[model samples]
Target: MILPEQFDQNELFVLTSLLIFYSLLFWLPNRFPLSLIILMMISSATVARLTDHLLSGSKMNLYSIMDLDKYELFDFFTYLLYAPFGYFLVYGYDKFKLQGISVLLYILVWALGATAFGEISLLFGVFKYKEWEASYSFTYYFIMISLMLLVYRFFKRSYKLHKVEIYNR
Candidate 1:
């Protein structure tokens, strides 16, 4: 078990490859079916666990927060919130309703909305995690939200192109 600090080149490569593979797989699949998306999510989670174990020599518990006891209820609720955000974005885009800068603004709004909701819930004692510092929180939200938006855009474009090709054929 390599600790997080002990990630060697091989482990790093494996993790990086898995990330890229999952991202591409999720991004290229048309329809954005919930079942397929869930499968991809599970695969990514499994890979994350494996990477943690390989680096730390122990099973990684998703329930464990960086600085809090397991808040199973809130954790589940948060996942619920996140799922809809992803679903709606893809749905809107696929329907050709959302486009250009509007789509981007929507993504940013949703990201900030989710972050605010999470922070408020934490403040209200619904969950226990360290409050994110302003800079770190912004950066984290930017990366996560951008990743999801990019994947959705990729899938949307691919689906459109595939549809065009099929019609032409």
Candidate 2:
């Protein structure tokens, strides 16, 4: 997809910030289901589109294929787009049953896998980017993954400390 020539730094910042924020939300509360996160992502995207329309006074073009009407295909792909990765994250965490440092490594592996898949999708034109370089994809993913690891470690440590206090009681 061809991006607009005029760059809006504020909008770009908001989009990137939201993506990272949501990524961290998904990473936390390890027991939280992926479906919930996917739902939140969809809702957020819809709200973003609506906000764009209100700001631009025009409806956002969803997607198109060739000259024929093919919005459904686009919508379907978008809906299912993150399911596999989300599933993999949850499943991998459970299957490996990691704890402590192992959890951090598991999250890193999942993040790398997700980033590779995202790059592949972008390369094949399955999705498009705006105001983002190809290399930025890796960078963004790395940041989110590192943030997830940090947050997870913080919570895990807190829980352990709480458990110790309870045991002392």
Top-scoring candidate (TM-score): 1
Pairs with backbone N, CA or C atoms under 3 Å apart (clashes), candidate 1:
2-55, 2-56, 3-55
lDDT of each: 0.47, 0.45
Task: Per model, state how many residue pairs clash.
Answer: 3, 0
Q: What is the TM-score of each candidate against the true structure?
A: 0.48, 0.42
lDDT of 1: 0.47
Ten-residue region with minimum lDDT total, candidate 2: 64-73
Best by lDDT: 1
TM-score of 1: 0.48
Segments in model 2 whose C-alpha atoms lie over 4 Å from true places? 1-72, 139-169
> Per-residue lDDT for 16-54 in model 2, tens only?
434654576566544433443344345434543343234
